[model samples]
Target: MVVSSVEKPIAKQPHASRLYRELAPAYEAVWPILARKRIRAAIGNLELDAGHRLLEVGVGTGMSLDSYPQSIDITGVDLSTEMLAQAQRLVEEERWSNVRLLPMNAEELLFDDSSFDVVTSFHVISVVSDPRRMMREVVRVCKPGGKILIVNHFRSNNSWIARMVDSAGAVTRRLGWRTDLNLHEITADFPLRVERCYKTSPTSLFTILTATKLDA
Candidate 1:
């Protein structure tokens, strides 16, 4: 997946919400160029139809809103109020009546089990405080046979590159994400069955991972 260039690490663990809050204003300007193509590739083939309920975790600024079919209902949650506010503005300005934005923690989703037909997170898992908890919550809220999609940068398999990225984790954390998160560890023991995995970005740094939730 798409790894960011290494920069100096910040000394302290910055508050997650605060980091996004500070980045919210500049997010749209910066991320669209870097993330749009990969995100579109990830959600483009979802089997959405009218009445389908979709939940997006860590839906920063709602950049992916336009990619979904208008017939589907969408609920998006993020930890940053500033990001949600921007998302709200985009939803209103674009007149996407089917979308709703809320400030929420991905690790502690408020919805009941099987509440949604689809669950997705774009460029989010690597940034969350607890990726395992976030994935579990995503799985919990999705219906059996539902699709769960994730688009993010995973650590490189190249030993040298992986080592460099892992060594730079302290610096990358300051920018709001880790560079060395292992994809296998993230999906370990999860109930979902892998359906597809492919590189989505031109540089092959970002990947699209799709899975189907199995019956209980």
Candidate 2:
């Protein structure tokens, strides 16, 4: 069973899947190359070992799936069934015995508390209707002291750059992504010990955040 059950919150936003379904082919073509280096570096920072349980939220097309250590167990979830279908095909082609792909909502993760040793999401925070809620759920499912990785484009701290980017917000929003998401705004309230939050390069548009969920 490549696809698993997901809850109804996703149904409230049917367009989410529609937009991605149409974009699936292009998404698989483009995102992997653009995100590979930063994602690989971020995963390297996780220091994963055999037997670790990892949950990747918004596992779109499984672009970053092969970068993870095969020894560890991986469960990848995505709201877009079209994307998940591509991911399932990849899992099969590679014969990844340790990976499971499921159709799931990021904001409504159906998992037990502390179910995974690590949780990671890429370029997905802003795509959701409520990024903070998605984050709360991200931290919720991760084991205490477990690592959490988020790699996404957030409003730049540079004033001029932020305003310049804001000009494109209208266009991006119409296409289903908001350009004005702020990193600190979404993550500040969580019980996470932020280890590092930095841009991959001086010119990189995305930020890489590495944090550990605080113990209850």
- lDDT accuracy of residue 134 in candidate 2: 92
Instruction: Give the total clashing residue pairs for model 2.
Output: 0
Best by TM-score: 2
**Estimated TM-score per prediction?**
0.89, 0.94
Model 2 misplacement above 4 A: 1-10
1-216: candidate 1 lDDT, tens digit per residue: 002221323233337778888888887889899888778878897777789999999898998988999999899988877898999998999999899877677877777889899999998898887889889989989999999999887998888767877888889888888787789978889888999988854457777899999986
Report the Cα lDDT for residue 173, model 2.
88
Residue lDDT tens for model 2, 1-216: 123355444555445667998999998788777888888888888889899999999898988888999999999998888899999999999999999987788887888889999999998889888889999989999999899999999999899999988998898887788888988888887889999998878998889999999977
Cα misplacement distance, residue 65 of candidate 2 (Å): 0.8
